[model samples]
Target: MAATLFPDNPDFIKRPPFETDELRRCLTNYLDTPFEFDPSGARPLVGNYRWGVYAFFDYDDEPIYVGQTNEQLRTRIRRHLTNQRTDAVAMSVLDPFEVHDIEVWPLPQFQDVDPKKDRTAAMAARLHLDALERRITAQAITNSQFKAILNEKDPPPGELTVEVPPSTRGCIVSDRVREIRGHPDFRIARRALIMSRLAQVISERQVKGGLRRVMLTQAKRLEWLAARRFEATGGARTVPQEGDQDGEE
Candidate 1:
């Protein structure tokens, strides 16, 4: 039997197998609505609109660690806490509230053998992730003092100090920890680290050229000092020093 064609319809010439006017209208509505895309402020645009991995060491679990890949971090972390999945790591860590101080890093792309594609983005992601893991591990090894500044409540008000072991190599500590703590999205952590590193490079260039630059370089150093003080006081607020103006210019 020959099917009747609607010659008057504009879409009849080459109709998709599952085309419908309702579907077209829905797509059109979605397209018309512009989305705000800020990777650091919101969720990642990849992995079903969420980043893929969550890696952390359990503070109370002695030596246990947790590393997971998921399309939704909140959902996965919730399941892990509630023992909803049999394969979930034991919830032997500290209470959920304690670990609520999370640091998320996004890996939009992974390693690939393709030669044509630019590998800079992927390499940057890997470097940031590796650094984060190393930092967390080092903190665990050195005790709670070396943990992320965000994990501390009511961070201090002055210069922060960090002691890096002589064996540590190619490690650059910046005010990224403060930015990540203020940032709501975990995926932006990696991006913030990368930006901090780039800013350092720019600052170095400016210094070498004898050009005056903004105060970001000084601000980063101050932030690091403030973070350390905050951690030492168990997240309590401290009176500002003679030179400190409550983060003011």
Candidate 2:
């Protein structure tokens, strides 16, 4: 997690961090990797029998959510990305339309584990993965300025890892201002993501829409949301407030 990514909560975690050299190394490596998430409009598919961890990154390629499973990497991941039949995405924990990319590490192969059905190996893998997820989530919180992630909840009580310092990892968000100043196109994509999210919310709320009044309440709220997000990173500048226009004769 980057320092400014999530909002902070003091009571979310307990102290005495655990040792997670592996988690630190994995997370840093993962962040540095270039990945294309679910691209096809069709359903998602995965066939790899790997117990592993995965994450959903937003348009700017920042992780918004993370999960681990000892099941087929395809089946579970499909549920998150391709299969909206499940409640996770529908519940808005992750906004499907705005998700920019996805990536997965074959944790089973990396850890030398077999299929998840094996009772003993699966148990060990699950425990390890739970702790692994906790370590990453904790490390992310430690480095975050807001201290909260949009992604996932922290793992329950267990052996905690030592607080990993904020990484100097190169990401799409790296050198944010320079990158934006250099490539202005990214700014448009960011705006689109925000608008897409608001659209989803408005639709979910069952708000009515028409030609002139096409979700105006939501449209206004979307503007506010976009302004705030951009303002946080200095993407927005002071502009004149939009005033109501009157019809002319």
Candidate 3:
């Protein structure tokens, strides 16, 4: 029996199978690239090897995200890291500025192997990259420290996957305790007062709005910081509440 071919339908095409070893080789080569730090905020995502997996790390060298891209990695990552308004780096979740370091697995070799004339190899490579990303994400989650990597959704061809816990949805404990505490601009002296005021504002408004969200975030950050500072300084001072702006003797 001969299969009927639809010429106008784009879905009809040759689907080639990639061997296990061939994929393994591609994955190995891509993964070989080491983690590179670009404090200057400059990335050379200008070449052929611009498609694959990327990871963001914080100042403490913690995993923040695990993602794969079919487009140019440079442009995609630049949007996340360089643009402040990028929705990719949600304030409720991960902040783009916190991305102190980036690591990539750009499979440039795939370009040559696939060439401009062939689409089959590129498609296969994308699938394999997704598989590799899932594998790395799963392994990292097993370790409590890395369980909080902020991947919005699981990659395709999902295999060996773990659910991002409800508690760890926006961020893990480390995000709250370490992110702000360890930042260079942490000024402990006046932060407690700020936290208290923010708490008070939230209490008064009692509405789930943008202003309230900001206040809540800062308050939590300051409260946590104040607690740590108090422990270090060995003296607990009164945290000012709504109207307690003036702390006196």
The most accurate candidate by lDDT is: 3
TM-score of each: 0.26, 0.47, 0.48
- Writing each residue's lDDT as its tens digit, candidate 3 over 107-146 gives 5445354435567887666666667677656654554252
Model with the higher lDDT, candidate 2 or 3:
3
Task: Give per-residue CA lDDT, model 1, range 193-232, as digits (tens).
Answer: 5335445555565342211121232234335545654676
Q: Is candidate 1 or candidate 3 better by TM-score?
A: 3
lDDT (Cα atoms) of all candidates against the true structure: 0.34, 0.48, 0.49
Point out where model 3 deviates above 4 Å: 1-48, 84-86, 90-92, 113-117, 143-146, 159-230, 233-249
How would the candidate models be sorted by TM-score, starting from the highest?
Answer: 3, 2, 1
Rank all candidate structures by their lDDT, best first, as comma-separated numbers.
Answer: 3, 2, 1
> Any residue pairs clashing in model 1, and if so which?
104-186, 153-235, 156-230, 159-225, 160-224, 160-225, 160-226
- lDDT at position 210, candidate 2: 27
lDDT of 1 at 122: 45
Q: What is candidate 1's local distance difference test score?
A: 0.34
Best by TM-score: 3
Model 2's alpha-carbon lDDT is 0.48
What is the alpha-carbon lDDT of model 3 when measured against the actual structure?
0.49
